[model samples]
Target: MNQILPLELPNGISLEIKREDLLHPFISGNKFRKLKYNLLQAKSEGLETVLTFGGAYSNHISAVAYAGKEQGFKTIGVIRGDELGDKITENPTLKFAQDCGMQFEFVSREAYRLKTEPDFIAKLKDKFGSFYLVPEGGTNEYAIKGCEEILTDKDANFDFVCCAVGTGGTISGIINSALPHQKVLGFPALKGDFLKDEIRKFATNQNWELVTDYHFGGYGKVNEELVQFINQFYQQTQIPLDPIYTGKMVFGVIDLIQKNWFLDNAKILMIHTGGLQGIQGMNTILKSKNKTLIEVQ
Candidate 1:
């Protein structure tokens, strides 16, 4: 559903949000889109186990765990940071995945970097037997195919479509399906220009660009200012945003609007890619540092 924000803006600009977050209670947003075809292919191939990778509070990990269980596939999460293995009880995301029957193989950061290496995958297959692999962040050809369905003919009137970028799959899908007149803006949660090439590998059009100024440090890093903004946004809109992704994108879009970066009378659509499940884990970190918490019911 698309809901227009009632905020007053300069130049008669209008802002509306696509609530992809409400797609599911667990496998919500882009995760749902990315996994839809992947799970189907896995089942068609007669694979009973699905293996994927992520960090401690990765939305991909949480979603894959629940979706796999719900679909009758055994899940294995190759998680970064070996120390997190024993800390599952203290981590909301990991605990939830465990509760959903997702087994974990925790590795060090250095070893985790080799996640895409052929030798590493060969070792995994040797140990765990045959299983369908879903890359980290769930970005693959099949995932992009799923993400391409996010936009519809009803979205053609919008001048700009904005979304948070992680693995570049979702934005690639958006870029592929966007109308030629509409520009797709991706606010990456991570800091870097490398994502451009990643997006280019899949995106067939040149209607998109990444706004890199609003990462708030980098992926998974948030401060008091961002926390305050998230709390304020939620209090006003009654829409919860996860600090890692959508919150940062929304903050950047509004900040750009305040700076009059958009043309007069421009209509903007923001995609809520859904990472609300990470809030509890983030609040745990924030409380440890005596920082303000995001108010989400």
Candidate 2:
């Protein structure tokens, strides 16, 4: 079982860490929460295989691959990136997926975009045999149900709850589970306010809203400010946050607090959706620039 550590922030804001990083070997982090229900639902329905979508280095893909192997379910990942079958080196995500016996299928950007289409999902089954298809970010009803467990386990009262909004599953779950008195804030990594509706597309009720303007740059974009935030956050919490998902969300949360968005002494629970391996490349890219990334916070 993972630990939920309580944190006392410098500004008098309090929160609890789900410590999902301690979940298991490969099936770790919020990924477990995000994937648990879909897998269970598939099992309940007697589906023998799981099919999902992701990029070359998607944490979702990594989790699905490892979980599928451990649970003895056939798994296929529709990957969107440069073809890797001929490459000698693979990103940690891809390498882990391969190690877990996940079958990989490459799709062009055009075809990959249509995977969510009913016709496209049907075609996938016709081509690859029978499978239970999950959306790219696992944004299905079952995924939301899995994520909702995070809130159910908490008995202590918190004024607010926060998490990175990728496919909005976790936020949707949190919103669904949070009572009317609790506030749910989602820091979306994407630009624009479009995700507010996208989040509601899942299961969020009146208790939630996506903070759309905090993406430091944009979806998948990072800068020195975020680098500084990640370094300082790691130094203070000993939690390694990748720039892609968790780092941006953390940065947004800190900014929200600093900006007085939260009541001065409000208690909040900021979830760390683990994707630390995604930073390996960013670290390499920054190291090549010959500057040590440090947080001044």
Candidate 3:
């Protein structure tokens, strides 16, 4: 954990960020947390293969691929776009996963929506044989359990705990383990109130709320302002943030602070849930669009 002192702010308001991104080089931050017990469970079940879902540039896909490779499990990624099948070399995340020996099962976006359906799963089982399944975004009871350990006893001093919300597992774990005096604030990377219900299913308390205004359009959507902010934030903080999630959360937190949304004398702790691996892929997209790229460390 480190205090952020570069940004001038209101008196008595201090900001600190947990460098969960440094937890691992590839399987970093919340992905590590989300997969900790999941891999263990798979091992205990004697499962030799792991299957999961993600989009073209999904951080989860990359993390699971590397993790499975490192842990000696065969990995399969159900990618959302069939067209991305031949474009692996152009997409860093997918290419990295492919290099890690993750087999790709590309499907149309519409068919990907049926991932949770029994028929879809049955088809996958028929094609790939038996395997352990992980949900998209890597959220589940085991994921929440791993994420609960993210905050240490020393973290209890902060008045607010902030983290980027994706699939709600990370924040749900934070909510369950937060100190009585600390409020957990989640900045959702995707649009919709649907996450509220999804979070409620796992979170045990009412001390957390999702901030929806800073999504920058929705998941995988970013504008010039967001891109520029991400670049400047890295320049100032020397901490690279993925535009899809962490960058938006940090932007929202700073904006809220400037607007006096936090109480006077509040100490805020932001969880740096890692998705940095996706920056290369995002930069590739930005280059094609003539947009600014996120700074790399």
Candidate with maximal TM-score: 1
Model 2 steric clash pairs? none
**Candidate 3 structure quality by residue, lDDT tens digits, 143-217:** 999999999998978999999998999999999999888899999999999999999999999998889999998
TM-score of 3: 0.98
Measured by TM-score, how close is model 1 to the native structure? Answer: 0.99
Q: What is the alpha-carbon lDDT of model 3 when measured against the actual structure?
A: 0.93
Ordered from best to worst lDDT, the candidate numbers read: 1, 3, 2
lDDT of each: 0.96, 0.76, 0.93
Give the alpha carbon lDDT tens digit for every residue of 1-297 in model 1. 898887888999999999999999999899999999999999999999999999999999999999988999999999999999789999999999999999999999999999999999999999999999999999999999999999999999999999999989999999999999999999999998999999999999999989999999999999888999999888888899999999999999999999999999999999999999999999999899988888898
Q: Largest lDDT belongs to which candidate?
A: 1
- List the candidate numbers ranked by TM-score, top first: 1, 3, 2
TM-score of each: 0.99, 0.88, 0.98
> For residue 1, what is the lDDT in candidate 1?
88
Q: In model 3, where do residues sit more than 4 Å from their true spots?
A: none
Q: Give stretches of model 2 more than 4 Å off.
A: 1-11, 153-155, 284-297
In angstroms, the error of model 1 at 39 is: 0.6
Which lDDT tens digits does candidate 2 get at residues 1-297?
233433445667765655556666577667888788888888998998999999866888888998999999989999885365554153667877888888888878888888778898888888888887888887878878878877655534788888888777778888888888888888888777767777778765797767876787787777877887788777877777778887887778777777878887787777777776567656656677875554322
Q: Give the winner by lDDT: 1 or 3.
A: 1
